[model samples]
Target chain A: MRIGFIGFGEVGYEMSKGFLTEDPQAQFFVYDPLYEKEETQQRAKKTHATLFSDPQSVAKETLDVLFVAVPAPFAEDAWRSIWSELNEETLHVDLTTASAQVKQRLGEDMLNEKRTFIDGAIMGALKVYQHKVPIMVSGTGSTSLIDWGKSTHMNLTYAGDLPGDATNIKFIRSIFTKGLSALLHEVMQAADKLALDDIILDSITRTMDKEPFEQIINRLISSNVIHSQRREKEMENVIDFLNSHGIEPQMTKATRDKLKMITQANILEKNQGDPPKDWKQVMRLVNCT
Target chain B: MRIGFIGFGEVGYEMSKGFLTEDPQAQFFVYDPLYEKEETQQRAKKTHATLFSDPQSVAKETLDVLFVAVPAPFAEDAWRSIWSELNEETLHVDLTTASAQVKQRLGEDMLNEKRTFIDGAIMGALKVYQHKVPIMVSGTGSTSLIDWGKSTHMNLTYAGDLPGDATNIKFIRSIFTKGLSALLHEVMQAADKLALDDIILDSITRTMDKEPFEQIINRLISSNVIHSQRREKEMENVIDFLNSHGIEPQMTKATRDKLKMITQANILEKNQGDPPKDWKQVMRLVNCT
Candidate 1:
């Protein structure tokens, strides 16, 4: 089956690789501005994938599926504007963390064009990309596509046969995962400021007592070190949720503000790199003093 | 051992009953303006336990342990002024859900007066009172008092030997427990407006996909009906924390705003009863339509 993918960044690259792993003979069409990045372009060539020159060219080439794996705060208006430029109405799958409202809106337009729209929000990290990452896909035309996804080794779960179902589910669950990670970062730092580090750790363990807040906290810190930039924006959304709840987000507020402050201070080894040691050391040691 | 409890309210009343059930003969010098309605007071009269006239009397009279089950949003000036009247440096234990800062400030002042201040926070519903509810206590005075508590039938867990430890621990856990409850309430209402209740529920359960958010959402909705007013205030704090993270909280913000609307509608029987519904219905149904 010939499949074409657009915007081969973090998620898209992995997805195209997954299809290749399933069937080496699977002819693939991929396009990414980053294909020029060191070894990426070579890997695309080695996998026997054709990198398309433009969206129109990619659309002209008849393909089994057109996967859209792009960054969220998605290009909705831009997508709609450019969407008309494409000539074909093929099965289009979106594997982005988009809002349910956006999916619902896009679903309507895609259906009118006689194409299939599947909201497949990948719930795994980039590491599990081509391997066995579980993707929750929900839409009017979802079940039909899941069969094809299975043949291509995509771990897909049908949340329900509705357009916005999977995205809504992903956002809800994300409230705990990403939101809590951001919260933990703040609280750990608060513990440091108040000089109550040991007690805070004890509380985290107790919070994790018969739960998993401890392990979750560690991963959040690691993720912040890696995706510190995205985390900053994500945490802003989290604080808005926290306020609406009337719960005191003791640490999360500090973490987000501190990130802003660091950025304002113009301290960047890389765009989204972790904060310096002074900040990192804030709650690393849980001492009485 | 004889103990005196000032503030015979929901938490106080229930905790005393647990003490009574554990040791029928345990003496309690109880004091409260609403001493008339206290089941503990009535039961104490039936069991012939001693009663004190006032807060001052409890301290002056023969009382081994002093349990201050005061309502929180504790006034710093008022608490300090009244606490100063104690004169005697007795075994003072506070089991109020006061702010961590309040606990720290008060703990320091009490310590200066050579008083053993144990920071204690109740860890379960007030209904459970004594039976299953665990008490988390921590402070410089915790070791000695926790020993006394163990000798007598107090359900206590020493969080750490530090001032303000217990409240910090409780509030942090509340960040998840009560915070999520409010978040759940908001989105459930939003789902109602969208007419996708089943979709949201299925998505959350699937996305939450076998984690504490499932059990946490279950417990918050099923049992612990936090006062909406308190929930509102608590959500504010969580929101402040989320703002620090730079993440946009969809459900949490929706939940928070809806809760404000719930507060506005005056759903609480007297405008201050348990939240609009038991958390279970809140999680499964309440605004879920």
Candidate 2:
């Protein structure tokens, strides 16, 4: 089997390591602007991959499979630069953290050229999963890619048939992962102010002992109407306290805004006679408003 | 032992049930506007607590300990309504989810009036823990209150001498819990649009197989310099995608704002030569900028 990689940055490097570790007999080719850099050169030599000076040369190598592991900002440009070199036989796959729109455009362009394009997005840290990361793939060629990936012990999921479904799933998933990080960052700042960092962390981790998702959903629905007014006021106070401590409570501020919107919409008052029975019902009330 | 409850709402009622279950011999008095409601009356009867028409009457019972479990907005009013009724022998502990400023004011007022006031904040769902919920307490009287709670098998922590320290911690913790709910709501709505709700949820819960806090912090720091630019752009796309789908991405919007702030401050560029070694280092760089 022959393979080519574009962009030997952190993700690209880790991916190469995983690929070589898993399939040592597979031939490899590489093309990155930093190919001449000492670290890049050493990595290429260590992996025993044939390195090419330009993307055109890597594309012209006529590899059966290609992984475009460029940075998100440079992904579209990179694909365009190597567009002419790829033919119908090359199964071109993207591994950039790009938007659905960008992925859809590239996928459509490739399909127009009678080439296989699989929109792929990694859902975990490259350092942790390397090439075996959970990759959400979409497009007509996704099934074949998933089959190929599974054979090599690479974790891949065929998201849907649409060009951008996989990327969309990934961006939406970011709402959970990145949002959690931002929340923790804000909380840690406050914990530091009180010199209660360790205790606060311990308290939070302990809460994780329970099913937080169920607890959260139950509390949200059961107390949605009973406490919205007071909760909103407390959130306003949170904004003040965070500001006083020189921290921008972006998430807290948004929470306050949302709470205010809820009260203004008067959904609770309207549903007072017949309150929501569950979290889903509560969401329906919210949406109706 | 004599005890009085200043409210008969959801939290107040659950607490009464738990306390009575643990100490059946303890005398109880209650006061709330809803005390006349069927549910409140039924709960008080079941718990064998004496119902009072007003906070003043409940205070006049000369209780050994009193719990203020009113809503956050009405907490101050409830305290003031019974201020003249409380005496030196009464240990008044608050369980409302109020702002630190409000808790501090009431605590100071109680101290000046020769009554013990412990600023306490419940750290879990009241429905789950009831009177035994993990309560973080702070103030001059917190130690004694914690000891009293411990005697009854209640989970209590003495935070510090200051009146508002415990409340501060609770408000800070809210950022994580409420922030998480907001993120989940946003993601669920997007998933619903694509009819991929189950798969998206499965993916997120799987990611939780790892230590989320450590994973989040590590990813945030390691990719701080390399992916910030791409991430910020992707977030912008997330905003547009969410809007196009008619879902207000409150958490997603806040995340974008935060990422923009990080990039705008250019902290990564300054620390390029010596990148942040950990989450704390990353935060220090953020604070420095």
Estimate TM-scores for all models.
0.60, 0.77
Lowest lDDT 10-residue stretch of candidate 2 chain B? B209-218
DockQ of each: 0.06, 0.40
Q: Clash pairs of candidate 2?
A: none
Predicted candidate 2 versus true structure: per-residue lDDT over A212-286, tens digit per residue: 455554565446455667677777888888998888889898777666655565655668757657655555566
For every candidate, the chain B TM-score is 0.59, 0.79
Q: Compared to the true structure, candidate 1 yields what TM-score?
A: 0.60
Q: Model 1: per-residue lDDT, tens digit, B172-191?
A: 45444333332333333334
Give the number of the best model, judged by lDDT: 2
True contacts kept of each: 0.07, 0.44
Measured with DockQ on alpha carbons, how good is candidate 2? 0.40
